[model samples]
Target: MLTSSHCAIEIVAMAALRQKQAFEGELNRIAGTRLTLEAQVNAIETANLNAETMIAMKKGAEALKGIHGNMNINKVDATMDQIREQMDISNEISDAISNPVNMGIDVDDEELKNELEELEQEQLNDRLMGAERAPIEDEDDEEAQLRQLQAEMAM
Candidate 1:
């Protein structure tokens, strides 16, 4: 009995070791894939940044030229003032709407609302698509058949 128990324990320990090695190998493979993906993302972001920098440089040059040329200085100032006023109004509206008291709700979560809206939209789309079926006959025939069925059912 003692020998049999020892054999059983040894078998379990070997299996456990094998499982551990397999898990470790899988973890390493996943880590490798993650690193590769990160590298690819970095490369793409670097390229995007380079392009944005070039565009910003060109825009800045044009802006400086316009400023130096004094092109409609008063018009620019008026537009800036109008923009500032609009931004202030926007901020006020945002502050009011974001407040629970203004919203008249105790637990108002914008994220939850957005998620619920998305789910509702998805459900609406599903119902629209799922309820569609081929027409059994022409519109005239269908109307006549429906009327006949309704008359019989009423009787």
Candidate 2:
């Protein structure tokens, strides 16, 4: 009877030990699976970050390309050429106004005065003789002089 009881206790202890070992094995498997899943999640996050960086770089490159297109060297040169031409024209006009001699616009004062007096005399005679009066243009002396100067400059 003593030997039988001892065998029964040994059998129970062995079963309990096997249950503990199976539980530990199951926990180890679960832990290993969790670690693998975490590693995969980390890899996916890193890939996403790299993808975002690549997309940002592409966008920046596109923006630079647009700027380059808008600021092309040929267009810049053409615009500068137009500006230079306008500046030259402005300078020439300034020179012409400041110094008429540069544009060969010389006039003899005596000759101009004599011609003006003759025209005035002719108008006076026409008014005295009761000639068929044409419609007057109402031009002042200064305006007439300016017109005459412009005509001379045109020549």
Candidate 3:
């Protein structure tokens, strides 16, 4: 049989072990609760930030729409039209500047008319010499063209 004092001491040691286990279980439960609370707070914070971002994007889109209302498409088209008009005027000026004889300042009207007539006469001679054509009843046209070309070439 065991001694009574030894038995009492064994019982006290068992009680102490049970108390220690209870304390550890309570500490673990408290720590788990604290972690769960921190996770819930973080999740709420993320959701709130997402909602704020969505609202800010919507407001920015609305502001851009308002700004577009003030922008005019017709004004842009009108500006392009003005640019095209200026380009056409500039091209006309370039053509005028490049041709001094056509400007009427260097050559008189009579001289211009004579140069155009001479050019026509040369074209007629080219057509006659470049290709063979059937004989025409109007011999006067050929005689007049030949005389003009020969006279110009002689000079």
Per-structure clash totals for the candidates: 0, 0, 0
lDDT of 3 by residue, 1-155 (tens): 89999999999999999999999999999999999999999999999999999999999999999988767999889989999999999999999888757445565789989999999999989888987885577668889999999999999
TM-score of candidate 1 to 2 decimals:
0.35
Ranking of all predicted structures according to TM-score, beginning with the best and ending with the worst: 3, 2, 1
- Candidate 3: which stretches are off by over 4 Å? 71-105, 108-155
Candidate 2 structure quality by residue, lDDT tens digits, 1-155 = 56988999999999999999999999999999999999999999999999999999999999999988779789999999999999999999998888645356678999999999999999988886885766577999999999999999999
| Per-prediction TM-score | 0.35, 0.47, 0.49
lDDT of 3: 0.92
Best by lDDT: 2
Error of 3 at 79 (Å): 5.7
Q: Name the best candidate (by TM-score).
A: 3
Q: Estimate candidate 1's alpha-carbon lDDT, on a 0 to 1 scale.
A: 0.91
Q: After superposition, how far is residue 25 of candidate 3 from its true place, in Å?
A: 1.3
Encode model 1's per-residue lDDT on 1-155: one tens digit a residue.
57998999999999999999999999999999999999999999999999999999999999999877865779889989999999999999999888766445566599889999999999988877877674465579888899999999999
Which portions of model 2 miss their true places by more than 4 Å?
Answer: 77-155
Ranked by lDDT, the better of candidates 1 and 2 is: 2
